[model samples]
Target chain A: MDTPDTLRYTRSHEWATDPADGVVTVGITDFAQDQLGDVVFVELPKVGTKVKAGQAIAVIESVKTASDIYAPLDGEIVAVNEVLNGEPEAINAGPYEGGWLFRIEPTDPSAWNGLLEASAYEAVAQEG
Target chain B: MQRTPLYERHRDLGARLVDFAGWDMPIQYESGINQEHLAVRQDAGVFDVSHMGELRVRGAEAMAFLRYTTLNDVGRLRVGRGHYSMLPNESGGLVDDLYVYRDADDDFLVVANAGNVDTVLDALTAHAADFAVEIVDESDRWGLLALQGPAAAVRLERVAGMELTSLRKNATRDVDIGGLHVRVARTGYTGEDGFELFTAWDDTPAVWDLLIEDGALPCGLGARDTLRLEAGFPLYGHELTSTTNPLCTPFAWVVKDKPFFGRDAMWGAPCDQRLVGLKVTGRGIPRQGYTVLDADGTSVGMVTSGTLSPLTRESIAMAWIDSSLARDGTDLAVVVRAQAVPATVTTPPFYTP
Candidate 1:
């Protein structure tokens, strides 16, 4: 429900913002946070690690269950959110903005075309 | 769907509703399970557990009838005492785990889980037909609330007008609370000192308000499950199922020496898998049904119940492991998701007072 039009999303619920510096900001969508209640622990990839699109790169743990965060686009992690390691509940509070998981530098700049727009992603997420 | 008297109250509190077994229940409140769990550990918390069913057996053969139904001996229960036991089928499988309270001469009360209410009632009804006892299903007419944690005693004393030290562990007594006659038992599943209040349907709302005013926070099923799991209590469905015996779980100590159902079948039987606790050493959350392995990656067991322990700030799981690999200090691997995470076999309960 907290989808920002400026951001692009994937069917798996990761949101990425194309920040003009070639480094896209990435985090789990608000819908993902709501489904996995009360995030207690977060495991993010280290900085400078490379990952392919659709690969599971991080782990988000909640009191009820744990889920994998897939890479929305192929990129190299430039920076990781250190705050989430200690206070994972930030995802439950402000998942779209302050709860950003990591920053990525995409290998192919045009790979963003595969991502879904806000309206398109919402329809897919609402199916079930 | 089955609805308890507190269903409307939970909805009024902005609870996340879910269908649990046939009942429309609250899984969490507006404050969430983490906040409610902390409140119970530090202060006081109350849960609307009216969904759990209760059966009353009263007659000259009440004791005899109960002795033939459960695996534990009813003859050992004195007046005003309660004992935790399980009903086992003829094949040595658990029918349901329940708490039996001795109310009076030729009278007893049995409290069973919410989902197993009908199953337990049907079993008891069929068995009682051969005896001189009358079995009454009082679940629909009563409301049960569990007031747990350190401040629980203080909160209940304000309404009961009596010190709670008299109601020791596993003790039950009839008390007048706010002009309403209720049965108060000193028992809980959260590993905290608390009292379970059983009152008439109409008196539940008033009693709930009184407890809230006395500093008892309202919690839901989420906190109840996490708290009980932290206390290392075994749930009926997850730990003790129709195919799982009580002796295989960590509750073998409660299995008494008695001539009851499934006694002859399970006598001197050996269990293939034993329930033990596992603490994940790697950065992965172990979930139920995940396979556990040894250092060589050979499969040893599978996780039965797992969760993030709020009190310990660690990932812990209860699993049924091979007897040879179920010893304490044994290093194991829990296959979480797709990767295997390093885990250590530890003694249950993951946390102790």
Candidate 2:
């Protein structure tokens, strides 16, 4: 339920940190992790992999169900938080901070504006 | 979707509700499936199992009719006792696995899976032509709850005002729970010491509140599923199906040596697969429909139900494999997310009590 005003979001419940030099860190939103229940395993995409917008870049497996973490925008994966391989619960504990999944070097630096802002994302979260 | 009497309570508690067999059921609560599962394994957890179906079988031929339809020998069930049984189909398959409670010599109660109520009812009715018995669908009239765990008795005794020490396993007794006559049975799907309370439909929410007030964790179906899977109990439509032969599963003991409907189809049937437990030795969790493989990478089985055990913290699964490969210490692999993860074959009830 925590939507930080400093971030952007997607209808599929992913969040992207405000880009700096075309690089945006991505992770599932707090609402996504909460709706996903207890996290058991996190399947992250490999670093340096080029991904298109809306591509399934990662998979979050909860005890009851598994869901895809789609790419928020077309980008190149620069880094992934390996801490999730061991402590997937980090996503549940601090989704915005410690639970970040991967970093994307967006193809278009200004493409970040196309995603929903915090207020718009909060409205989508409230729809649930 | 149908709603249970505790729908409002579940929503208020922030439970994640999902559609389960046409019923709007809570899959997990705020604490999540892991916490709820551990609560039942350690302390106590209460589940709103009001969506489970109930059928009343009565008349002079009640016992005779039950024995005719199910795989278990209903004639051997003593009054006030219940046993896990299954309705068999003539095609070497199953109608459904159910609980048979003998309330009296001429009256009985059959608890069935919510999705398979009509199938079970029709199967029984088809085989009831020769017997003088009345099978009534009383699902809408009763609300059921399962209070499970090591601490369940202490918590339940405080509210129901009954001495539970003398209640043997699988036994039932009528107890007055807040002036509402409720049938409290020492039975449960989770492999824990607990009771399944059957109360009037409209009055169940009060019972739920009373139990919650007494310190039982309010659990959802998600926890119930993990608990049952950890205990190696089979879930209908997962480990079992209309085409599954009970003789091939570890629950074959439920099929007693007696004459019953679908007897020939089961005992005389050819079984190609055996249900066994799979413990993941490598990374990744096994899920349903995932292909199971032998060490040489040849396909041999398919996973039915699986999860990371909240108690053991190990990835475990139930799968049906070629009968020859279903053995203890058999090395295997489960295709998880398109990768062949290493696994080992073993028997069920993965966690020891």
Candidate 3:
């Protein structure tokens, strides 16, 4: 329910921070984590893997379901959150900060702005 | 979809609701499934099991009718005692597994799965043509709750205003919970000492309130599933299906040697495949329909139910596989998400204490 104004989001609930030197970190939104119940395991993308926008790049496992996390923008992964392999519940505890799944070096940094803003994402989330 | 008596109560508690067997039931609460599961194992937790069905059988020939229509010797049960039994079809399979209680002389109560209530009733009624018995569908008249864990007895006593020492294992007795009276059974699906309270349909919400007020954590079906799976109990649709013979599972003892429906076919059926527990030595959860393989990578079985234990954190599953390969400690593999994960044939229950 906490939609920070500085962040951009996807309809599927991934949040992307503002481009910092053309690199933006990606993680699922708090609403996504709440809907997922409890996080038990997470499968993160590897560093240096090229991913296209809207492509399934990661997997998140709750206790009862497995969901795919999509790439918010076409980018190459620069780093992965290896700590998630042991402590996936970080996504439930701090989805926006410590639970960030990966960092991406985007082909077009401006695409981050094209995604839904916090207010628009809030509307989308309300309907969900 | 149907709604249970405590549907609104679950919503008020901010529970995540899901459709289960045509009923709007809670899957987990705000504290999450893991916490609710551990609470039941370490302390006490109550589950809204009103979605389960109940049928009452009464007549001079009720015992005889039950003896012929289902597995387990009905004669073995004394007054106010219950035992796990299976309702088998004419084929070498099961209609549903049930808990049969001899409530009184010539009167018995059968508890069944929600989705299979009609099927169970029809199966029992079909065999009642020549007997002096009447089977009544009493599902709507009761709201069931399972209070489970090590602290369950003491907690229930605090609510019932009396000691529960009179309630022995697998026994049932009528008790006064506050000003209301209900039947309390010392039986549960979880591998814990618990009581299943059968309260009046209208009184269910009050009973739930009293139990919660007494400090029993409110649990949902997700925890109920993990607990039962860890206990190695077979679910009706997953383990005992329309064509699954009970004689081949660890619950084979439930089938008595006496004659019953599907007796000949089941007894004559081959025991080539059996239900066994599997522990994933490799990564990934081995889910239902996953193929189980032997050392040579030949498909020999399929997973029925699987999960990571909330208490023990072991990736465990119940699988039906080749009887020859079902021995404990025998190495096996399960195809999980297209990867063959190393596994071992372990005996259920996967967890205790």
**Candidate 2 deviant stretches above 4 angstroms:** A123-128
Q: Which prediction has the highest DockQ against the true structure?
A: 2
Chain B TM-score list for all models: 0.97, 0.98, 0.99
**lDDT by residue (tens digit), candidate 2, B160-265:** 8878868999999888887888899998978999999999999999999999999999999999998999888999999999899999999999998888877887
- Badly placed stretches (over 4 Å) of model 3 are none
In model 1, what lDDT does residue B347 have? 81
lDDT of 3 by residue, B147-190 (tens): 99999999999999888966899999898987898899999999
With a 3 Å backbone cut-off (N, CA, C), the pairs that clash in candidate 3 are none
Candidate 1: chain B TM-score against the reference chain B? 0.97
Better of 1 and 2 by DockQ: 2
lDDT of 2: 0.91
**Candidate 2 chain A lowest-lDDT run of ten:** A14-23
Candidate 2, A34-126: lDDT as tens digits: 888899999999999999999998999999777889999998999999999999999999999999999999998788889999999989889
Work out the TM-score per prediction: 0.92, 0.97, 0.97
**Which of the CAPRI classes, incorrect, acceptable, medium or high, describes model 3?**
medium
lDDT of 3 at A14: 96
